[model samples]
Target: MTTTQSLPHWNMDVVYPGLQSPEFAQGFAATVKEIEALVQLFDASHVEKQDVLTVDDGLIKTFETAVEHFNSVQDHVLTLEVYISCFVSTNSRDEVAQARESELENSLVKLSQLDTRFTAWLGSMDVEQLIAHSEVASAHAYALRRAKAESLHMMSPREESLASELNVSAGTAWTKLHANLTSQLNVTLELDGQTQQVPMSVVRNQASSTDREVRRRAFEAELAAWKEVAVPLAQALNSIKGEVNTLAHKRQWESALDASLFANSIDRQTLDAMLSAARASFPDFRRYFRAKAQALKIPQLAWYDIFAPLGSSDRVWEYSDAERFIVEQFGTFSERLSNYAARAFSEGWIDAEPRAGKRDGAYCTPLRKDESRIFTNYKASFDGVSTLAHELGHGYHNLNLAERTALQSFLPMTLAETASIFCETIINHAAMKDADREERMAILEASIQGACQVVLDITSRFLFEQNVFEQRKQRELSVEELNGLMLQSQRDTYGDGIDQQTLHPYMWAVKGHYYSSDLSFYNYPYMFGLLFGLGLYARYQQNPEAFKQGYDELLSSTGLDDAATLAARFGIDLHSEAFWRGSLDIVRQDIDAFCELVQSQA
Candidate 1:
């Protein structure tokens, strides 16, 4: 949380003193030493733990005993790795950190190999045997079952190894290239009668500027900057998607979309229902946008104006005030959640500054043995509370899974937003409930504005990616061609609400989601997160006590079951368009209220 008092960057000193610290050196050495033990033990245990269906004490001596130990060493290894992630995130250019990270990554290969072997080994065992094994089996039951199910797609160990190596030079390389390209990007903006070089991150934040001239100039500067890297970025995107296309085809998948579904452990029917629901909800979204345009005193909104603040007083806060608001609001929900945020803020578990090297977005990274650390480029804007709440929501999610085995705590995109978005909804509702007429209108406007982005703008991103892949099949897309596709997607998704002439054409260039070969169509998951979160919030609204237990169960079971299976806990059928539309309907209700508020003033 940002305060008037200077905030400190995350104290990696707790993880280790420094790159040259004995703790860092010893931790890395211990991890490598532990990896060797895991490797030798995994190899030797095969001779002992026969794939017998027996669940006797002899079987426990053979496999389960060894697995519990393996998990212990594995947790230590993870703690070391996550420390490196924290080290590099705030200072990407630390050569010592970078060099050590590369070294640690190489050592991690052995651990990964052992994991694959373990997964494959479990795949051969009968379900009843796993259930009978007790401790380790009960702890990581979902992870083991998921691995066994996915072992259907497993290549040979040697082939899998080669595939990973190829990804390093192929897909991973391009993602890195995109990161390096964007971070180094210099956009010159003429402000206050002088020219200054702006980092791409700083320039993009200007889109939310209250001053229209500044917003327009910033957009222009960002466009100019993106132009310099457009060719390379286009190539980067083409290469990344092309690699996925090649891999999926070789793997006998129908398409990259199919591969994405499998990786997320979700079915095509659910995705179809979600996307179709999004497209159908466009009319209501446009209506909200039209009302917003009136509220902003414009006929229609422009690309830069999309994020522009609507009210005259764009409230900023002291860091202390921000902390109190968040803690009090969270306490209104539950004491457990408030305690997590209190600890995160008090313990310096967050990097809360807008520094040059820190990443643009906020994320909570889970360290299984310890707690999660949140990273954000904090500025005490009106939206700062939402950002803090969102991250703390993630922290709370981590806290729920903290006591569980590391393997069982993995959350996929579908349920990952459950806590974070729900936290946002809680805080948003509280703020709106307490505000005066002027403040209430402003708050609702801001809330609906963000809702428009996730629901409508996210859909536009999905369409743009679909078009990009289709066009990218024959040849690489030129900057103009890519820009054309983006504008068309925006028109198709946003319809007449967003002024076409002022749409962001170079959106594909800045967004890192497009660059990830691993998470194809990274856009819709956010839509799912928002809508899924809303759906759960609705349940909470009905019976807070009943929903609280079910909500915790849902988050805990995310890694255990697929999207459709987990939704069943709340009697949700994700495959039904009606289920998704139910969430959209909630948004429509909010929009209607906002529109009425604005029109009453008229």
Candidate 2:
């Protein structure tokens, strides 16, 4: 049977069978009514008074209950939004489908005001009084603090209302335009002596092909195609950053980075420690890259050639084989995680097929409150199997957090990758043990590619963002200027080991992470996730049983604590270099084995 046929359906019936269902429509309508009704009780001046604790408590409880209800409304809509758009995004020429997507986003955008009003209400509260309220004290201690942090930067009620409304049409609308434009841009490639219109994802993926000519051609074509839209992309970025920086200043924030840090609930010290660990391990990545360049018989490694396969692996895993492999590898780490994966696959929870209109990448969206729906475009390759493991890891993370109150289940970005990267480590290590000499090279090379991107490449992106902010303080960057910043960053991180002549200049145009207005410094979190996960995986390997319990406890605590405190449970001092070195040590072993395997073949 096909993978789709065997896969289980996610449980959406608990909420509603469709958007038109009474429960779904009623919930959405009720959310609108609640937001509209809040205006009667909303008064900015009331928040400053003391002894109004009873009144404040009622407002806080009402808001929390309303929000909990609204989350289900939005979550259900988003599930449909992603499921439907994933199909449409795969096919660029479907204008009607694309129009429908715009409508869905517009409806969501209209409710953006609800969030603004909610924030304003929270801000108006007497901080001391808000803290004293039982419902506020328990459900949203962290959120309350974060809200206060932001509320200070906000304008008064009238100005804040105007700004929030303008943002939807100005900053948000421009970013969406950039997305729509980029998504429609198609690249034509010369494959097997025939001209084929390849999706952008396929073009990029093929840049990793064993054939050097194919790799170079794909990179050249992809970048050239992106060049057409680079100017607009640059404007999109500049406009968003301008608005963000201006707002930060108005709020009396020192910088956009400071504002983001407060919102993310992460300290600058933790960020510094994470960056220090990544940079210190740069040599390990450089060594791995140099080895790959040598194996490929290239004078210097170019950006496109980084993902080139090193040796042959005739192991073509079917979807079923990949499923079993992931389950077995996860079982070796923690049976709880393993059982979660097993049930997800067996219970029809995944949409795992390469269909015509399916989305480009994989993600796990939770179903109502208890389950998750995973989408995958499986190409039956090694990377596909790894992607499956990664997404399932996210599903299990959601499963672990499902029991938490609606308020507590929101995991921070840094801890978000814990499960996904853990699953990757497990599958990669298990596959390494039994593969033949050639397959070993393929596996090791693949491992290095992922590590370098997560470590070295992310470092470059982080540097680029830092440069953008520093320069933004002086003047806006043009397309050419942004390209220069991106390339300079590449040279800095990749060192003399890379062929600078063939570096990717269109990175600013292609990567959505950089363009996201809501998040700043989106790059470093990947490094944190990988290194932290590696540390957890190392612990698991040392004492599979004892560490398994420790690992679960760590994951559970992630939603409630910071990185340093969470790592403490595992006896890992995240502030110390020793913990980071322990993680990098795992990478070193793999690099050494890969070098040996390549030399033996030579």
Candidate 3:
């Protein structure tokens, strides 16, 4: 197993050696001065409701210049803070180090004021005049439109600024509390005639144990531990959602989903289509779940039982072996992806190891001026290899978009999954091709296990979030009410496949995605990304030579256009159910082969 020592060396010194550096001082002072100047130019009386279309050439040019400068300064400062905080988080455990983190947090909190001022100024622009500014009209037109849409949800500038600041102490603080409680909560799992304190991550992974007794124990202990903190966490979630709803009402918006979707830059039509496809695909999911339950010899599968091993195959790859396997598989599909993965490993780009005090889970952060950075906790298991592919896919996506400006390089949630899922598909396809019968069973089970989580499990989360919003409008949700809603959502999605008695009721409290104040309906985007990526992968399989170029072009163009246009380049129509069904058909084919393979073994 890889340890914390294998993580990337934090290189904040590349920006500046310390806060005392001349570069840091100059950049910090310059950003503050610039923000003050922009605030002074916000002529509230004349600018209110004045569209950029009607603004004179001089004023328009001035506005454009101010925006560019403001964005540039804001991006640089925010990026620097992120780099520093990540460094601090990875290394510092002492009080002084923590105090330094507090300082950075406070500074970032203060900068939230500038965010409100800028948004209000942008909102104050006359619709036509803003649209008519040639510079703004030509480039980043989508961003400009999105800003205007979001601004429509704003209250008076004063209230908006207060909300921005209060969020630091409200939703943000409660989430921090939840993080602390969960990380420190230990489940005293009785194993091997001894009591051992198990972390949540270890307990969750135990559900994959080939030993049924172990999984049952882990599952029971895991949920039991949550009872200790579920009440406070429930309060945290309800409070945050309440604020989101009230803010939406104040802005005269129709719903929280509408505001969130606008920020996500997706439309209701696409969301509805995605949910419909997920619902329609339940039969395929149920088939796989039933097969697994039979294979495991269980009367009925429970939530953790869904990950129960179907075969006694145990194949472990070392870290280097995992890397080589991923790169080779990715290369087989596309040289572009292979080359990116190779560079990510050869260069000091990947932080592919687990460590104490490091944040759990995996992510790939792309630095506009430098190479992308990948983080993961590797346990030398099959899932770890899949994680490597997933994160490297993100790195490759970043590499493809490296030439674009930072503002233009950011892809929305819908299309962000394309490169990542393509990478995963390449690995899964290769495994299916090369593995022996037992190995194939393991790999297929793993893939299906993950897919069900992304599709079926995510569907439950979507339903739960929807119900929470509806009930929240009436009144706040107590812990008991919240748990009931969660179980209902799971039952709806899992149906007869999952035993209701053993379903995870603390799911909403554990998932951090629900706590986000900004991103509502975050659940469905996973299904959209996965199915969309599968559709693209299917196209690539048909004509590898021709489609490879098209795939690369699609990724490069993702930042430049909306999801629909970007997908259309690959002959995909986001609006059509047929398109999503075509993608699900590919997964169905996999499930078919895996079923036959398992039956032959029996």
Q: Of models 1 and 3, which has the larger TM-score?
A: 1
Per-residue accuracy of model 2 over 436-536 as CA lDDT, tens digit each: 77778888888877888888899999888888877887778998999999999999988876888988877877777766667767777778888989998
Candidate order, TM-score descending: 1, 3, 2
Candidate 2 lowest-lDDT run of ten = 44-53
Instruction: Pull out the clashing pairs in model 1.
Output: 2-319, 3-319, 4-319
* lDDT scores in order: 0.78, 0.71, 0.73
Q: Using Cα atoms with residue i matched to residue i, what is each candidate's TM-score against the true structure? A: 0.93, 0.87, 0.90
Instruction: Rank by lDDT, highest first.
Output: 1, 3, 2
Cα RMSD, model 2: 3.9
| Model 2, residue pairs in steric clash | 7-348, 8-347, 8-348, 8-349, 9-348, 87-357, 153-251
| Backbone steric clashes in candidate 1, count | 3
How many clashing pairs per prediction, in order? 3, 7, 11
- What digit string (tens of lDDT, one per residue) describes model 3 on residues 168-252? 7777766666655565566778777788986666666677777788889988998888888888899888888888889889988
